[model samples]
Target: MMAAFKVINQYWLISITLICSKILPISSETFHTRLSPSYFSQKLGKIGTKLIINGIDSHYRSFFARVQHLTTPGFCGAAILDSRFLITSANCVHSVKPQDIHIEIGDFSLQDVQMTIYDVQDIFIAPGFNLNNTPINDLAMIKTEEPIPDAHQISIGICDEEDYDMINYQKSVFGCCGMGSTNKDPFIKLIPQVLKEMHFRGTPMDESNPERFLPCREDNICTRPMIDGGSICNLDHGGPLYKFRCGSFEPECLYGVASYSKRKADRHFQTCNTGSFFTNLMYFHEWIALTFLQNSF
Candidate 1:
């Protein structure tokens, strides 16, 4: 009974995933969109699928941390930045106290990996972050009680403008990876925390759409699912919008943070592939470096 109270309010700390649907698309009409993935074959790209980039566990290595809200049992996406720091969206930890939240790692498939939970020693949100605004310096870092073992420090990446732009125009498809919300429902034992992945294409900035209000300027990058029926729905916030480098097989850079997505209909309670927005990581590279230095000692 106590376990039931834990997951009642969990949400995806990553995206509300912008890409269109996946795995056979919902229908003939749902399978075709301007930015949808080119092929409709049985290739894998779904929210619950195990991450298999180049057949390695690289995805699990990096974004293995979950910033769990102790009381609400809510969660947000986070990743290992260094031995002592885990990074996530500033809004994810903005209002909560450091002691109230915990970081859980070392688990991929909820059933397989032995989970290690750590208390947050400190919380550091980016400078000038505003929750009212969709995406602007939407970043944060948390210090653990002690350094996470180096063996668990597998996923590492950089945020440089050069690499960010290269993937922006050059890459044909980008992958949004996350282990989003696992509803804390009673009938179910809690969903799988396995890393899931989806594909989407960069879309032109749309500032005047009424159904959505995300402004994809220098700080935010908008996306349309590369395939129809794909989306990073609710409970998947603070997720990563990443892709492999040119001629490289591994995803070494995380370019953006999944912020939010528009609803399917004005009053409906579903996510739409209509559009999605993410916080650009390159924009805050200097600030992040500075923030890390200030907290290093």
Candidate 2:
């Protein structure tokens, strides 16, 4: 009788396991926190479908300065002010020392082991740069230990207040590039090995609701892609947003510096569905000019 009872209990447990498997399918969305090529391929069968959710490979005609820490590389992007100086977001270098900061310029492909890296001699965060109230005066200048080669230099000017006011900010297409994440999911960290460029236009602010986009005050410039689907993600902060002439490869005037992205209060990740915020260089023209002039002597 005891042997019979034990055998029945074993069969009952097996029956319950089978019932649970049938009720709950194995391929539920809750189990997947991240998306990948293999997951799609398995679900949709390999029918030659490709996923491109980020910017394309940028041409070498434009100049960009990549600002990062030696250990945490690709944290932000920057513009080469000259052979000896670079401009970036204050948040990128605020807490770090100059020695630990690494600046790499003119590298189309970051994977190349032969690429040269410059050392940081000094860093100056613009006055009134507050981490508590971020993206406000979110600008910084990096001084290189050795002067960068002049051959890589280009005549890029900062957009002044007059130009900013006269131009239709929402109408013109701006060129931006960075070593940012290719994937929309920031947690996945899908940073591209090559520099990628995307075209986006400034989003017009609502006069009635001026304070809707918090942390992004009147001084900041917001952007929306004119054509593409994805926006800038992590590792793109401190990058430049500039205007280029029609059919020209070289940038004309520097307007904005990448700062942050829009997200709800509860969400931990920054969404790419909307435009990203940038520190308006046009608003800080006086500060930048003064800094450059003082250092000149």
Candidate 3:
């Protein structure tokens, strides 16, 4: 009887943790427009499949980290900025407390036992971050309690306006990886144990149709999957949007952070091929740098 009671208690604990993790403070004005990821996928259409439909397994990215709650697995993907700092979307940690979250790195698979997990020393959400808004300034920095081991410590690339513009206009192909839900079927939430990566093409601002694409503010960049039926969905949030050199599998520079996507007013289903918005990291480079300096021990 004691064992059975313990199992039931554990189950309830997990259920409550998941419920709390999903709660976010939203303004009434934006409530109708900005719904949860699952709702957005359901109202518009099916969310992407695979780790992104057709996404391939990424052995691992040394600089990538999984930012998640202690009880819930993960809500966002993050990029390591240095031995002590990492960056992700504000929405991922805005409502979370530093002591209640952890960072996982050096593991491609969620179930991998060799992954290193670290306690969060602090969390710094960007100024003027509004969860109800288009997740504007959707960036945050996390300081690890202890420096990550030297072997796994590396800086990720942050772009400047000039380079960002070039990539957008030149339509450079970039990639993102995460362990988000593989499929968006309302009845199913299929997240794989392995990290997955998919490539997307930069969608020039001029080419974006307001009628079809969500209202992408100046702080955001738009992208569409390189292939049909591909996209970054739930859990891909806060992951790096980065580029690679020709014929290279390694990431070269960071451009953006996966933010949010919305369906057209007239559309009933979410479509991965239409494109999605990412928080432009170049716009926040100065702020992030300043934050690093202020917090450096």
Candidate 4:
């Protein structure tokens, strides 16, 4: 009797696993690749100079100063609006103390640029952000002690009303930029690895309410490509998401800071693919204008 019971249990477990795999389908293989630490280090070395923040140093770009915490160490972020400010998800730094946050800029290989440490005077977390839901207001801003001159001149993308119409059901391509995780868990290995491909087509918008959920507009589509917590950015968080405009692709607007993923419903024990989300910056346009632009530094 005991032997028969064990066999039945094993059969059921395998059956369920197989069924779930089919429903999600593990995304497309054209999407996944495993990246080693050495490869990531090399990639960072190549792109590090372009990721300047506050004109202080090149090393500062390695990690977003505000988001790193004691528990999950060495997380990455991007500079959104030049060197002075960085836009990252609020969840990244949810546990970090304000005083502990530090920004590393300058040289990629550790010796070229001087590192500048800035005190975070204030942090603006978006309203109505739910840890469980991962709502639209997942955005946050980190204000540094001093402004880095020439940081504003760096090109950043802006959201336009036209994007809402163009993005719907169109073959839109988004580049997923960020550092890969060093954590190794058996379950995490199953999904299509995130680092191999930099960009992919946006998934079609499901028939869902736009007012409550994100990617609220037609042009404002969202992606679950890969690389969570890392901003979907070029060198910095405030980096632009370029759309093919006019005769050529231009960096017209900046979108949201990349945030956490929604878990798969069926897999109670395992995390689904790295379903990345970004905090929509459009919601806080007035606030940004008031605080960063109009207010005296």
Q: Residue 267 in model 4: shift from native, Å?
A: 4.9
Single out the weakest 10-residue window by summed lDDT for candidate 1. 11-20
Candidate 3: segments with Cα more than 4 A from true spot: 1-49, 71-74, 109-113, 151-153, 167-169, 206-216, 264-273
Compose the digit string of candidate 4's lDDT tens values, residues 1-297: 344335333322232232221223332231122122333344333322222210111122222232343344444454446555666666555446656565544323343335455556556565555555444455566666676555655525456554534343144334333333322222332211222112223444421232344433321345533122222322122222333232112223554455543344554553323344454456566666565674336
lDDT of 3 at 156: 78
Error of 3 at 133 (Å): 6.7
lDDT tens per residue, model 1, 189-282: 2333476555556765653266555536776667766444455545456766775544222465677777766544453433433456677778
Give the TM-scores of the predictions, in the order they appear.
Answer: 0.71, 0.72, 0.75, 0.54
User: Once superposed on the true structure, which residue ranges of model 2 sit more than 4 Å away at CA?
Assistant: 1-53, 71-74, 109-114, 132-134, 206-216, 247-249, 264-270
Model 4 lDDT-worst window of ten: 50-59
| Tens-place lDDT digits, model 3, residues 69-147 | 8766566899988889888889889988899899887667445637788999999998888886357788899999998
Residue 242 in candidate 4, Cα distance off native in Å = 5.7
Segments in model 4 whose C-alpha atoms lie over 4 Å from true places: 1-67, 70-76, 94-97, 106-117, 153-155, 166-169, 180-197, 203-221, 224-252, 263-274, 293-296
For candidate 4, the per-residue lDDT at 56 reads: 13
Sorted on TM-score, best first, the list reads 3, 2, 1, 4
The lDDT per prediction is 0.59, 0.65, 0.68, 0.40
Instruction: Indicate the residue-level lDDT of 37 in model 3.
Output: 41
Q: Which residue ranges in model 1 land beyond 4 Å of their true spot?
A: 1-61, 107-110, 133-135, 151-153, 170-172, 182-193, 207-215, 247-249, 264-267
Per-residue lDDT value at 185 in model 1: 22
